[model samples]
Target: MGVVPTDNELTGTVRSLRTSNSGLGIPKLLATLLSSQPEWSVSEKRLRKVIQRLKSEEETNFHPTSSLNSALDVSKYSNKLKPILFGPEKGKGLVATQDIDAGEVLWREDPFVYAPPWEIYEAQMAGTASWQDETRSNLTKGKGTSNKLGDESPLSKDAIWDTYRSFATLRNDQRWSHTSENDLARSQLENTFRRLHTVLINALYLQHSESQEDVTFDSTNTGSIPAPSRSAAHTKQLKRLLRVPIPEATLNSLFSWDGLMEGLGKMSLNLEAHGGLFPLHSHLNHACRPNVSIRHISPDGSTNSILHSPNPSRITVIAASLIPAGVELVVSYVDPSLDLRSRRRELRAWDFGICQCGRCLEEENSNSNTEHPEISGNRTKIEGGDERDVGQLEDELRGFLSV
Candidate 1:
């Protein structure tokens, strides 16, 4: 023998042999594709097929196994606020298991589940026929997606869409891309991260829509999702319309709870805001003279989470306002001093039937009759001649409050 091989050496030889030779013959460039990954070293089984192909000499019934089982994740920290609902249960509603106090920070949560923008586009293209038709009819066609962020010459659309976010793909997608020049091992090993602040911000906005009209795009115009226009400029404009923001601002301007007002009328749940959101706070029933109020803390310059931990990735919920025994713990979602009618309207939009709480009933009884001066219309008389214009009054109220 050239050299007497030990058991370990013999095993190693057999492995190399198994990798390089298949039943018919050895493999070709497969070895180069897998073994020379610039990122990290390949495992035995990982290189087997490539080696076999390079050798062009196959073995009988060869199978190479590797230690590439998927990693297991068993963390129990899920967003516990599963069923955020608005309802009028003759039942006690979402009552506080413990007492809450004023200036207390309630819990917060990542409200909206975010998906990659590319994935969003893909899903929309697949189901929404309007978007697909519009895209295909364009001179650019599929090129609408992968353009660079800025194309100075474009009359139509700019190119940012086609740019693949490698980090997002790695974290969520495992369909291993064959197009990239980077080695598979290197790509897999990369720990790059990109912040998705926009999704969080949109979630905040969705929680409270300051511009009521933004709630729904009055789809009276059936020509939704834009018709294909010949001009690249118009196509670009349509593209812009289709895009949602990618990053959300750290500071989100607060909205007085128009929705909360309606909830008060329905006596559904009382919710108070101490700044951050909470697990079950939204589910609290409403009482006119609620026990809780939302008090916003000052915003910091950089992005911040409501949670007070050293690493504020997760949000925390604490009591902002106090709750009382047998008080049905209500908190104001919007400004507290709203008159009964406006309050009822707001609650109605929030899906509450009516405000039957003590305060609301009192106001309604008073507005209906002049005899009870005690409840005399709670609304101040408009001293000017514009008293009859309830519509104007509504507009003024909405404008002043920024709801």
Candidate 2:
């Protein structure tokens, strides 16, 4: 008589089989188990019971509605700063809840989704000989590569689900919406998605390649390895896993060409230098003279001390100057030292139009006065006239201008 399999052993086998073939029915699953483990005696009725219990447990644990609630929650950071609508034109902005002293920390937040540099992503997609050589050289030197999280890492189903959820949340969030219908905005949206698509394609390729390599390595080391070549069927399974099943409507809304472009535009506006999008930090509007300073710091607040410390994922918002309660917190999106015209030009290119900040207004007014026709005419007369006349005219103009 063959040895009868215990309930625990049957449950474990069923789980492994289901993980590999999610669509396998109870009858087929039992047949596969029996064929593989011919020495073990198991009844089809007992196997069916185990599968049903597992399905019930999965249904109870996984709630689709709450999958993203934790990722989108900003309650922890709400005590110091809050989002307030600044009218239709300006939309929403962050405001200080109470008087904040200079150098005080307002909040620290992690990026919703962080990506590697555009150049790196492009290189990976192209798979150029130079890039391959560089990667090999770095490996030889014991140097770390650009995509530490992605390179040679086993793809986790949970990580893929989390990434998809975060992206979906970003796409649906109305706070990041831009109501502009200008050609410049449209151009920017297209460009943003062009780059995003490249990155996504390259990421998928990398994961698939890494998974294949893992399979190859395991087969070489162990005599008993399943799916030696990681066949097309297995590849299909991996692609399905990476895709993360979502409703047709939700998928269309998140990934349709127009939807993708719009989503990328929102990300482009708020993405940090290293391609990170912070939730609360995105609410701070631009200012010529910003009251808040943004800093990337390690958990202990010292980045330089740790060699190759992972990209300082957490950003600290410090009060650059004393900020009064209920005041809108702002940060400089461009260099503050830039002159008025140069600053305005840069801002315009970014679709921000002219800045109306106090410093910019004062500078613009001063420039306007200096260029006034009367002032120019008086200056010209003074330059061409005799020294005595020039002095008299200067005195007259100064008095007229109340200088």
Model 2, 233-305: lDDT tens digits are: 7789989998897888888768765455335434534223556667777677788899988776765777442
RMSD of 2: 27.7
**lDDT (10s digit) by residue, model 1, range 141-208:** 35455444353222222221221133344444455566666455545444222122222222223312
Q: Which stretches of candidate 1 lie over 4 Å from their true place?
A: 1-92, 112-281, 293-318, 325-327, 349-351, 362-403
Q: Cα lDDT for residue 110, model 1?
A: 36
Clashes of each: 55, 0
Every candidate's lDDT: 0.40, 0.60
Q: After superposition, how far is residue 296 of candidate 1 from its true place, in Å?
A: 7.4
Q: After aligning candidate 2 to the native by TM-score, how far in Å is the CA of 132 from where it should be?
A: 17
Best by TM-score: 2
Task: Report the Cα lDDT for candidate 2.
Answer: 0.60
- Native-referenced Cα lDDT, model 1: 0.40
